[model samples]
Target: MSNSLEILQKYWNHDAFRTPQEEIIASVLAAKDTFGLMPTGGGKSITFQVPAMMMEGICLVISPLVALMKDQVENLQNKGIKAICLTGGISSDEIIDLLDNCEFGNYKFLYLSPERLQNDWILERIKNLPINLIAIDEAHCVSQWGNDFRPAYLKIVKLKEYFPKVPFLALTASATKRVQEDIVKLLQLDNPAVFTKSFARENLAYMVFNVEDKLHLMEQILKKNPQPSIIYVNNRKSCSETVTQLESLGFSATYYHGGLSPKDKENHMKLWMNEKVQTIVATNAFGMGIDKANVKTVIHLHIPPNLENYYQEAGRAGRNGEKAFAVLLTNPSDVIHVEAQFLSVLSDKAFLNLVYIKICNYFRIAYGEGIDEKFSFNINHFCTKYSLPILKVYNALQFLDRQGIINLSQEFTEKITLQFIIPSKEVIRYMSLNKQDEEVILTILRTSPGIYESQSVINISLIAKKSNTDENKVLAILHKLNEKGVIELHAKNNDATLTFNEVREDERTINRVAKYLEAQNKLKTDQLKSVLHYIKEEKKCKNKLLLSYFGEVINEDCGVCSYCISKNKTKTDTSTLSEKIIGLLKIQDLNSRDVVKLTKYSKDDVIFVLKNLLENDTIMVKPNNLYSLKN
Candidate 1:
């Protein structure tokens, strides 16, 4: 077997492992159950991937993120390593072939979602493979107390029943002490060797500011940094709006959200990655598997749902060990808005059951049926049809998804079926009579040849391009043809797809998972409260607060965070700072930055003294938008 370093150098081109990574890899190599706790950018994947390379047989990886799984698999394949990922949308036959390939086709890695372990057929097949190691990514999900708990992760323990002697390596980026204990116990890792890296990023500065104008503050932060950066907003609408706002402020920016098409997401991501754009404004969906090392700033427009999420997102910056800033720009309204957005949408068992029944009926699935059946689901149409609140329904669907009752995929797609009721000759004659619709009709005829015989799926965008028109115009033409009895048009827009993983037993299904649903809701409430406290508490150092929340203790202040800077400023007499600011204003009108630069004081101290002067009517702003002495 090759040495771990040799494999790392061969595949990843890294000369040495990060601190404690080599130790964790050695533990896994020794065939012992191991647990590794590292920060988000601590190269957790290296611990498992390097060791797995030196082992004899293929390594089995269990991860909760399908996108991440695919990304790792693609990365490994690009490095000339054989890897396969089993996610949703695969047929049983294809899965069987894939498993067979793992068994004999010299494959080295197979990544599966935890939900896949629930299938007896897949588990039996996995038991027969020459599995040398079991690695669980995001291992904290096994704990109910963790930030993002998935009940499906609890089923991962069953793997032990299949391969009792195979070593297990559990890895997570963020887990508190309580969550850490839960993971070891729940995964049944027998006396696992634990390795934990300190949760402190020495070069990263954490800053939180209460600002009424968040966009203006964001502009100032970007202008100051002027490097690769990310701005995280809460929703899809905010992603585009923030990008637009940044562009208007003379910054090159792009937007990314879950709602964007796959091609668009890739294009936008490349724009930011290649440095063609200075910043990427995105929702939380944008950062998984991202490997940019020089992100100078990661600014949050609002408080994140939980500190775990915030830490992971903020950690995306400064991977190169350079000084980077994680700034949270918030206002008084943010707390109320976050609560309304997350807490108010908590659905109980009864609500979940109601949603379940409505969905089954909406898809016309009878009880004792619907297992393995898939449907194109339009959430807005379903909510409007059932007169249910969209957010509540969405939360309930997510819960149901976590429980393995159904699989919900949020990939947006459009399905259109078209058939011509009229004969082809009659259609051509009718099109000739309508000169405006002739091009679209001919394009559709050329594109969809079988539409005259049966309803066939057609590409509207392609037809639009071929006809020298837009999609809306082509759709209008199709509707016109349908109204005139020339063609049969059936078009449905789907933002999500739903697949039933279990038979529909109505309330009984929801009852089985009622306790979990309640616990999850309570967990969300607690997480939000902690977020509020983290943001509101002003006495302690922000870095210490974040590290302490993750069950780490630091004796010295980071001296770079917002609280530490303010604390240092308080040591100097405020009156002295105010007099210095007054001195600067006495010379000429100055803005806050000018005051800070000229006085050689921190921005926080300068802003503090300026506020005091303004309150005392000792200074005033002239038409030039700079501080001036009141005359």
Candidate 2:
């Protein structure tokens, strides 16, 4: 077998591994189950990919996101390594063929979502393969205590029973001490060797600006960091609004969210990726598979629900090992709303049950009848029909999904797919005979491959550009071709998916799951408290606080963070200055500049002392901008 470094050089073209990666890879190569706790962009994928190549049998990688799985698979294939992923929306026959390829086609890696482990045929087939190593990505999701918990991860433990000798590698970017323990016990790994790296990103400067005008601060940050940047907002509307504001300010920007059509999302991503747009105003859904290394800034316009999310999203800023800024722009009202919105959703049993029943009625699934049935759900349509609150209903659906009551999928199909129903010769003959439709059909054939064999995704705009016509004209021609029985065209759709994991359960039945909901609510509440604590904390180092949350300790503060810099710049201790200012005030009233001159302190320090004194009722700011003792 080739050594890990040799395989890394051969495939990934890297000289060495990041800190704990080499150690973790060595452990896995030694046939020991390993657990890696590293931050995002920590090169966790290499730990498994390199070792899997060194081993003899196929490496079964169980991941959560379909886009992530597909991306890794495509990346491996581009490197000439045989890889396949069993993702959603594939037929049983296709799954069988794919698994067979893994078994017999000398494939090195096989990727699958945790939900696919429940299939009997998949399990039967997997039991026979020469499985080498099992790697779990986003392993924190297995713990109910962790963020992004998915109950389907429970099925992963059964793999231990089937492949007793196979070593397991569990990897995640962020997990608390409790979540780490839960991952070990739930995955049933046998005495796994654990490797943890500090969550501190020294290159990333964390800043929180409490500004009355957030848009102004955002504009200033964008102006300072003219490189590629991401501005995260709380909702889709904010994304569009931010983009509009940036464009109005002469910044090339675009927006992305879950609500956008697949085509629009693609166009937005392509524009950002190609640097045609300098900034992308987006919700949290924008960063999963994105790897633009030179991203100079990541600004959060609205506070995230938790610090874990905040850390993960902000960590995207400095992947190139260069200094970058991760800023959170908020006001007092924003913080209040963040807390209020979370409180409204926590442990609302009635609301959750209402959503559950409405979803059942929406699908016409009578109680106790719809088991394991999946439907293409449109939240807008359902909300309009039932007059339900969209945000609450959406949160309730997410709560149900986490409880394993139902599977709500937001990864919608975004590509325009087409396949020729008639023979290629017949298509050619039709195109030749029909001169008006010839250019569009020929452009479709040239732009997208495999259309003759199977349905392949096509870019309508690209087709239009190639055909020298508009998108509507190209789409109309494709529709005409569908009518003529020459092809089958599938347009991009943004509908979400709702899968009924079990029969429709009543409120009483759902009450059992309510306990899980209660637990989840408590988890969310705790996470929100952490966010509030992070925001309110003034004395502690920001980097130290973040590292401490993930159970790591640092002896020295990251002196480069905003808090540290401010701490360094303030020469006069606030307590001493407050005392001097209050004593001076008791003697006689003094103006703001006069107080600064008497104390020999900067204007900011003087102002800080006066504000403290005012809050304590020791002094007051009069209309003349003078400080006076208050009774």
TM-score of each: 0.81, 0.78
Q: Residue 227 deviation, candidate 1, in Å?
A: 0.7
Query: Candidate 2, residues 1-631: lDDT per residue as tens digits?
Result: 7888888899998898888998998899888989999888888899999988988889999998777898899999999999999976677799999998989999999999887887777899999888999999999999888988887898999998989888999999999999999999999888999999888898999987654457766887889889999999988657766787888889999888875776778899999989999999888878887878999999998878888889989998989999999998766456657788778655488888878888888889997888778899867556656767667788888778766677787754444677899988999899889999898888888776667865666666567767888878987888888898998888766568888867887786578777667777888889988888887687888888888888889999899876788788837788988888878988988876677779999754775567577668887666544678988
Worst 10 residues of 2 by lDDT: 409-418
**Could you tell me how far off, in angstroms, the CA of residue 252 lies in candidate 1 after the best superposition?**
0.3
Candidate 1 lDDT by residue in tens digits, 1-631? 7899899899999999998899999999889999999988889889988888898899999998888999999999999999999998788999999999999998989999998998999999999999999999999999888877888899989889889999999999999999999999999999999999998999999999864457777888888999999999887757756776787899999988876678888999999999999999988888988989999999999788899999999999999999999998876457547787786689987888899999999999999999989887777657756668876898899888878899988664335778899877898799789999999888888877767766666666567777888878988988888898888887756468799999999988988999888888888898889888888787899999999999899899999998888877546578988888888777888777677678888766666677678779998755445678998
